[model samples]
Target: MPDAENTLLLVDDRPDNLFVLRMVLAEYLPDCRLITANSAEEGLTLAGRQRFDGALIDMQMSRMDGIEMCRRLKQEAGTAIIPVILMTAHHAPADLRARGLEAGADDFIERPIDNVELVARIRTMLRIKHAEDRLRAGNSELERQVAKQTAMFREYWKAVENSRDPFAIIDRGHRYSLVNDAWLKLYAIERTEVLGRPVAEVHGDEYFDAQIRLSLDSCLTGESVQYEQSFSRNGERPQQLQARLMPIAGEGGGIDGVVITLRDVTREREIERMKDEFISIAAHELNTPLAVIQGYAELLRDEPWTAPYKRTQRQEFLSLILEKCARLQKIVDDLLDLSRVDSGWMLVLHKSRWRVRDELDRQVWQFQRETLKHRFEVACDLSCGEVSADRGKIGQVIENLLGNAVKYSPRGGLIRVQAEVEGNVLRVTVADQGIGMTPEQAGRAFEKFYRADTLDTAIGGLGLGLAISRSIIEAHGGWIWLESEVGKGTRAHFTLPLMPAGTEVAIPNEMSDLKIAGEEKP
Candidate 1:
């Protein structure tokens, strides 16, 4: 936008001199507004109320000389910056002009002030005023923008600092620009040692085993890099950490820096370890039944007509062979389920709201028919309202828990199953009066391929059922925990939120990562 209309203040006591000045300005500079102040009192009063672009005054006046008027204008801060030009008729000696300047006149003019010279001098003063005003305005705007940018940057870094993930930012020169608290904690590095230093120089041997320096250098070339590393400290298990570094772009779309982020993946690695153990144990367990089935089939085929293989005896042998084959198939099916759970391939139908009591009753009836040794009983709410959960997953959990209760109670004992409403939750507990576990064994019982060494030594299992059950229960936004004492009994309790039948629940991240890790396992 064009500058505000140029305004000038003219002060002179002589009415005749003022008239000449006003007439000259009006004729030569028609667009300029000349505000005439007949006396210093009038000029000072006018200046106090309004902002003028410039001022012009005569050197001689009554009551207040023009030099005195200029001095007064320069004294007060409000008017100090208004450019003052003095009109001097007595200019024979250079002292007069010097004295006028000393009194704060920007420039002195000799009378009879030439009409053109007077106009030219006034225009010069006006131009200087306009330039200074523009410079001041530009500086004020710049300061405001700087403050706004600073506030935005502060908020951005605050969010980075609060994140649980370790994160860092490096500048175009590869010097560290930002490092969050998590980053500092993960690396055990101090803030003083990192900021504004070259990333390579600062992290020279910190990640000695991994190619972290190379990864950072690759980011400067606009590459996104991710890899895993293990950090071991003082005899404790090494923590597996995954690091990813990506290029940060500048305003011109150039790679200016890098963003480095890392997250702990130790549990992920442990789960993978369990998966490997499952494959090895499954193969070994499946071989036992297969060998029995194969050896008997060969005997029946080779000695069909022998006297020792009488029809009745052959029939008995064939029956035993069929049982072994069935056992083999069952083992294969269970292993397949373990695989499905690990890879998240099992699609559990969350159908109509079904009563927990109905599910428990079915399991109880099956157990009653299957075995006469262990007694299975349910103590749950018969009319418990519907829950929003995957019915199949819940049933699977119950079946696994009940099966464990029976398997551990080899001497025949009572197994109690329960489900009830507690405030906004549906709580379930399964207790077995069996040879239980030590504290250390119970703590790891839910881990895949984990079992109590003593009790499970002669038992037939790959130890994946409890882990799979735990995974399913947790997927429904519920929790599962167990308490056991050596030679006593063990009770496992779980809780699910009580809500409307079809409430949506988000599956945990471990479940998703579990699937990916399982599929990638050997």
Candidate 2:
């Protein structure tokens, strides 16, 4: 009579009692299966194995009385909620029937051996069993649906909290229901001050109403609004943020709430402003020097009057113009390199294999020619070993190091360059016996526009050489460093991975020809 078959546990001590009840109950409860136990212990064992829809027990038994057994069954969990019907003899008296009911029995049937009454009671219990089972099944189904929904909401909430950007959900009444940790952190506010309360009550009516009206209008129309805003908090710097507000829909396509996301853009906006300022300063520096050079050169050219006066005056003026031009060119180059590195457009190499000794020899020769008076030395433990690196980039790194060695050192100081293979990397060091830097100066030697203490303070250039050198070396998965004692000397050191012999290193595209032909004549 139910949607599924019901299992019944019948306990009795007498073999005759068990056999008669099984035959009678089998015909009456056709849809139910009967499990008969000879003793109360066996009945409990069966109940432990599987769930039973209902249980029946005889009043009198050899080992345990049915009333005590019923009490124990009710005490045991898993079987505690199952309905029980106690069967007894007609002569058992009204006090005994009251005793059975006191032992957690739902109902009792007197045993008169009346076939009709026994069948009728069994049917009545089966009907009650079906109704109880349906109620339990309904409760369990409802609980399962609730659990599934709760799990889904938990996962969505976790995602919102884990997101890097700020996010929140506001109900139709402009009340905050869900705000992730990032959203709270961004505002530097607490949940208790905002949640379950109208936005106007928490943040003020004017500000809250304006934002809510805009967001709700956009969201309900299935549109999204994105814009930037700035606000000051607790006397700190005004924080800038980019915000996006979108509508969240409920079941049946009705607008439920608005989802707002805010991303911090303060750092990005600051960097952009700094870039514009740098460009303005650089233009002023460049144009002023060029204008001076142009004015002096024109005066010397037009006033070439007396031969001796003209040659001497013109040459001295020409030298000054050339020197300033060289300084201006160096500034322009440094600016270009900075732009390339900052924009992430600089060259990067992968698995470049180079001949360390050959690369160092070429660099030494180039520097020797550039600084004709300065003596350069190259000492290599492994003259023919191969080193893995970007050939052009590493060469530029070496050139910057050696050039700095020549520039900072006295005209005749010793500049020694060396390279050797150590473990899986090739270590290169360029040591110059020149004026060295103090600990404070060495600390910021690789910083942009940084310069160390030198005997001559009139050196011409923005100090981006070492900074660019460090950037290039680090981009190749290597490190560059410098060691110096204030007055002793400075040694620049760097490393590159050593490849197996016979690997070819690719040249970088940033290298260009420095044509002395176009430069002013000496």
In order, what lDDT does every prediction score? 0.78, 0.76
Per residue, candidate 2 scores C-alpha lDDT tens digits across 315-421 of 88888899789868867776777667666673546445556788888989877776766788888884437766667767778878887888777655789998776
Cα lDDT of model 1 by residue, 1-522, tens digit: 122388889899888988998998899888887799989889889998898888888877789888888888889999988998887775537776777788788987788889999888878888888888889899889899989899988898888889888998887777888899998887688999999988668767665325666777788888899998887666776888898888999878889888988888888887787677667677878888788888888888788454567788788888988888877876766667666666656445464577888888898888778788988878878546677777877887888888888888888889899888887788888899988887667777876676565243556777877777767776676677777877788888777776666554544435432211113311
Best by TM-score: 1
Where does the lowest 10-residue lDDT sum fall in candidate 1? 513-522
Q: Each prediction's TM-score against the native?
A: 0.62, 0.57
Best by lDDT: 1
| Clashes within 3 Å, all models in order | 0, 1
The 10-residue segment with the lowest total lDDT in model 2: 513-522
